[model samples]
Target: MNVVCIGSGYVGSVTGTAFAVLGHPTTVIDIDPSKIDLLNAGKSPIYEPGLDQLVRKYIGKTLFATTSYQPVHEADVVFIGVGTPSKQDGTADLTYIKKAAELIGAYLHPHRFTVVVNKSTVPVGTADLVTAIIEEASGLKAGEHFSVVSNPEFLREGYALEDVFFPDRIVVGSNHERAKNIMRELYHRLVERVSYEEISKDFAFPYNPLTPKAVYFETDVKSAEMIKYASNAFLAVKISYINEVARLCETLGANVLDVARGMGLDSRIGGKFLQVSSGWSGSCFPKDTAEFLQTSRKYGTELSIVKAAIESNRKMHEFVVEKIRRRLKILNGKKIGILGLTFKPNTDDARQTQASVIIQMLLDLGANIRVHDPKGMEMFKAVHPHLHVQYCASAEDVAHQADGIVLLTHWNEYLQLDWKQMLSIMKTPYLLDTRNFLPKKLLIGLGYQYEGLGIGTEQEIDGGIMNQFSVLSV
Candidate 1:
């Protein structure tokens, strides 16, 4: 199959490269000249482990990048991956999708039956809209000349190539039998593999241990689109639920880690998104939840739980700031260090990250902030250039002369930081583990006053740590 992927960000860059590796001649289309040049030069414009390696191996052989949509006429499958960023009122801004669809329609061959796959996460009725637009632009019937598919992506950042090569499930949503068959043939390598035993023997199937084979689910277009939104929104709600539980655990003097582990041990409750953190903020969750809520309202329904999750997520950031305020009674002129900036580790994406909100709160309180991340600092600075933060070169630099330190994203290297040296350098040895990701016993032993969220009576459980609030009694 000659695959043409629209857009060159995370989705197109990784997926297209994987397709070329899977023996499909893939061409990535991007409007940005720099992105196209990077792809052609055997470098991925976005950060995904091993993606550039794959691109380099197949660059001019079976993989290509270009700004022109002229190759659409020859493509058997064309995937639309344009951005659907959230609008002000929580509705998806479909401006990019519209333009991509228009260009695809204009360049579509009259005789070529292109399987137009909606690779971007979108609303339920998006496939129909795309079909209508293509029909009007190309002067051809949809099923006769082309077909639209709702094939939403489920790739996680930091582990994109692994997920692509060894997917647990592949979904194709379209009414046309021909289009579904074409998609099946396109993904036959993974879906119709030799045996379930072959895949299980390697990974132990940690992603989906219960599933045997990588199931190629065939469903209606609307259902396929809903699956992506519902799955992401459910995970977001699950994260918020645990954070709520963690808050309650703090009041009741219970260890959240133990409670979460007990809850996860249940076969029904399965622990994927149960970790307590500053809150869920990433490229997908915040945007998708808002759009899901907006779509529900547009069709005369309401998702009250999602609304609460959004509000709770905002409060989670405030909750972290309040804990900092309680520790340092006055935040003015305090030098605080932040360990990580990306939503999670191993990806350079800084979109809608929790660090932005937490840092803004510290800045508002007149605190001087220093931050460091192994891969996310460049992206964080690009998105939040207005934020007055010192971009430290290393974790030790962030800790230098700092009054307190907060570990937000649990990068692996943070585990090996010289805590004793950090404590020695810091003006005040106060440390808060926002994700509960660091070693509390070691930090406490190292003479730094260690704090973690929802540990057994560590915070706000019995009137503050060691009667520190007793001084506030008036």
Candidate 2:
């Protein structure tokens, strides 16, 4: 099958590459010539664990990246994997998705049947909107020559390639039987190939002797799209709920780790995203939660709990900043060292990262900042160059000439650092572990004043400092 993927970004690149690896002739289109050139040269524009090898294997053979749209007319199936960024009103901005549809339609040859899949995360009813735009642009009626399907992606940054190859479920949202069959065929290779050895080789780990084979679920188009939104929104809510509990744990002298462990053991309440941290921030969670809230509102239903979750997550970051402000008394002239900048570890994606927000807030308060990230420094420098911040080679370099330290992102390197030695170089031995990735006892024993999201001494917990005084109905 000839497949064309619009927007060779995180989603497009990964999804397109997956299809190409499955023996389909795939071409990824993007307006960014440099990104196209990089992919053509077997250099992945993004940092994914197994993407470079995947690109290298299939770049010229079955997968091709280009800035041209001519392939849109040539392909049997076209996947629109562009970004639908959040607007100020919290609604998804569908400009990019619409443009991709428009381009696909305008260049498409008439009388040729094509399946248009919404590979990007879009609001409900967007598939209809895409169909309308394409119909208008191509001068073709829907279902006659082309059909639209809402096939949203559910990929994680660090584990995108693996997720695609071994998806838990494959949702193909289309009312057209032909379109659905086309999608099924496209993903049939994944369904047929059941190889535990391949999975173990991919992770470079021994096979779990007790683990079961992977399973894939197939569902209708609407349900599939809803699954993507609901899944992300629920995870966002889970993270926010844990953070809120962590705040109370800080006052009650209850360790959040223990609380999470107890809560996780309950079969109904599985432990995932239950770790108490500053908040959930990345490209997906924040935007998807907001979009889900807006989508609920549009459907005449108020998802008050989800809305609160979004607000709570935002406040968590501010709470961390406040902790710094309270301890330092004033941020002016204070040289603060930030341990990490990316939204998460393993991948250098800073989109909507809590650290970015916190750093901006600190800088606004007249704090001179020194930042170090394992892999996100290059990306961060591009977004925040005007700020009075120095990018350092190592965490130790960032600690030098710093009055205090903030562990924003829990990178592996940050977790492995000699905290005592790093603290000794700082002007002040103060550490704010927003992510709760550090050991509280070790830091305090080392003579450093340590603070975490929801951790403190027994006196601090019993003093009602961290407890939420007003209890709400659960």
Candidate 3:
């Protein structure tokens, strides 16, 4: 099968590369000529683990990248993996998806029957919109030469390769039987191979396979689109709920780690997203949750809890900043050190990152900032060059001559550093573990004052509880 993925970004590139590895001839298209050139040269535009290796393995043979839209008519399957970013009012901007459909329509060959798959996370009724746009542009009636399906992607950044190779479930949303069968066959080999490997590590393949492999759940297009938004919205709600609980735990003399562990062991609640931090950030959760709420409003329904979660998360960044201000007394002349700048670990993406927000707030308060990130300094410097900040080579360099240190991101490199050596160079040995990635016992043993969200010592328990409760109530 020939598969063409539009918008060769993080999702499109990974999805196209995976299909190519599965023996399908895959072409990834993008309007950015530079990005396409990089991909065609066997180099990835984004920073993802295992992606470069996969691109190199199938670069010229099975996988190809281009800036032209002519490949849309050459493939039996076309996946629309463009970005639908959130607008100011929280609605998903479908301009890119619309343009991609128009481009695909203009170049589609009349003889070829193509299955247009909506791989981008979109509104519920977007598949119908895409169908209409394609029909209008191609001047062809529906079901004559083309069909639309919603096959939403559920990939995470750090573990995207692993998730693609072994997904929790494969969802195919289409009404036509022929389109469904072809889609199933495209993934049938991978599904059977995975099952065979699971049952027997060294399983032998039959020369002529007779039985049809069943691996995907077939549903309508609307449900599949809803599944992607619902899944991301629920995870966002979970993170916000835990952060709210962490705020309460700070005052009640209760350890959030213990409480989260006890709650997570219930099986129904699960242990994911229970760890408290400076709230959720990155590309998916924040924008998707807002879009979900906006969609709810459009349908004359209110997702009150989800709305509260979004608002609370926005305030959580300020909450971390407030903690720093209270400790240092004044920020005008204080030199603060920030450990990590990316939204999370293992990626260089800084979109909607809490570190950016907190750093901006500190600068507004007239503080001198020194920052260090394992892999995000170059990206961070691009956006925040005018601020009174210095980017250092290592965490120790940033910590030197600083009155306080803030751990905004929980990168493994930050965790592996020597806490004693980092504290030794600081003007004041005050450490704020926003993500709770520090060893409390070790920090205190080194004679440095340690603080974390919802993790307080016995003295803080008595002195801070009343004050926290009073503030929370207000």
Candidate 4:
């Protein structure tokens, strides 16, 4: 199949590259020449683990990048993986998606019978909207010349390659039976796990592939679009639920790690999103949840659970800020060091990160911030240039002369840092592990005061329930 994915952001870039690796003639199209130039030069404009290798291997051959929509007509499947960023009122701004549809329409060959896939996360009725736009632009009859299919992407940023290549379920929705079958044909080889070894040999596939093979799910256009929103919002709620519990555990002198582990053991409650952290702020959760909620209101309905999740997610940020406040007492002129700036690790995406909100709160209280990240610093600075912050070179640089340090993002490099040495350089050794990620015993043994969310803090032996347990202050 000849595949063309519009918009070379995370979704388009990963999706287009994956299809190209499957021996399809794939071209990634974007308006930005810089991104196209970068892709053609064998470099991914955005950071996704194992994506560059595939791009490099196939750039000059099966995989290609361009700033043109000329391939739309020649393509068997054209995935519109453009970004629909959140508007100020939290509705998705479909400017890019609309523009992409317009371009696709202008260049769509009326007789090709192409399957125009909505790979971007759009609202319920967006398929009809896309169908209308493409029909108007191309003067083509719907269901005859071209059909829009809602095949929303379910990729996680750090695990884009894994999710794409080994998805748990591939939900495709369209009314047209031929379009559905073609969509199935588009991923038939992958779903059947054909040539799985040859295609994935060079790529560093994400560690955990729980499902043996991908489930090919079929549904209507609107349900498919809603699946993307519902999935993310539920995951956001799950994360918020655990983080909220983690705060309670801190007071009750219970370890949230144990609580989460115990809860995860139950088949009903999975262990995936149970891990505690600063809050659920990443490329998808914040924007998607807000947009999803706004969508409910627009239709004169309510998603109360999703709304609570958003509020709870906001409180999770405040929870971390409060942790900092209680430990340091005063925030003014404090030399605060931040370990990670990205929303999550292993990607350069700093969009809607909890770190920024927490840092801004600190800055408002007069805390001088110094930060370092393995990969996210540049993007963070670029995203929030107005916020005055000292961008340090490394973890050591961030630690130097710092009063209190917070581990916001759990990057692997931050874990391997010389905590003993970092502790030595600190003016005040107040180490806050927001992710419960660092070595608590080592840091505490080294005489630096260590703190982690939901981990039992320094408290006296309170003999109440599970045996007489003496929990030392960590």
Q: What are the Cα lDDT values of the candidates?
A: 0.85, 0.82, 0.82, 0.87
Better of 1 and 2 by TM-score: 1
What are the runs in model 3 whose C-alpha is more than 4 Å off? 194-215, 383-388, 458-474
Over the full model, what C-alpha lDDT does candidate 2 score relative to the true structure? Answer: 0.82
TM-score of each candidate?
0.93, 0.91, 0.90, 0.95
Q: Per-residue CA lDDT of candidate 3, range 111-162, in tens?
A: 9789999999898999999999999999866677888998988888767766
Better of 3 and 4 by lDDT: 4
lDDT tens readout by residue for model 1, 397-425: 88888999999998877876777778888
Cα lDDT of model 2 by residue, 1-474, tens digit:
899999888899989888887778999999999999999999788888778887887899999999999998888999999988999988899999989999999988796889999999988788889999999999998998999988778888888876777666677778888887787787777666545455345442234535433354556667877888998988988999999998888778877877887899998999878887788888999888889998899889978989999889888888888889988989999999998888888788877788788888999999999999988889888876666688899888888877889988877666567766787788998888876666555566677788877766432323222233222111
Runs in model 4 deviating more than 4 A are 206-211, 459-474
Q: Name the best candidate (by TM-score).
A: 4
In candidate 3, what residue range of length 10 has the lowest lDDT sum? 465-474
CA lDDT of 80 in candidate 2? 94
Ranking by TM-score: 4, 1, 2, 3
Q: What is the lDDT, from 0 to 100, of the residue 136 in candidate 1?
A: 85
For residues 1-474, what per-residue lDDT tens digits would candidate 4 score against the true structure? 999999899999999998888888999999999999999999998899988888888997999989989988799999998888888999999999898988899998876789999999998999999999999999998899999999989898988998898888999999999999899888988887677766757778533334588889999999999999999999999999999999899989888888888899999997889989989898788889999999899888989999999998889889888888898999999999998988888898987798899999999999999999888888888889988999998788888889999989888776567777887889999988888776665567787788888887763212212121123212
Can you give the lDDT of residue 412 in candidate 4?
72
Better of 1 and 4 by lDDT: 4
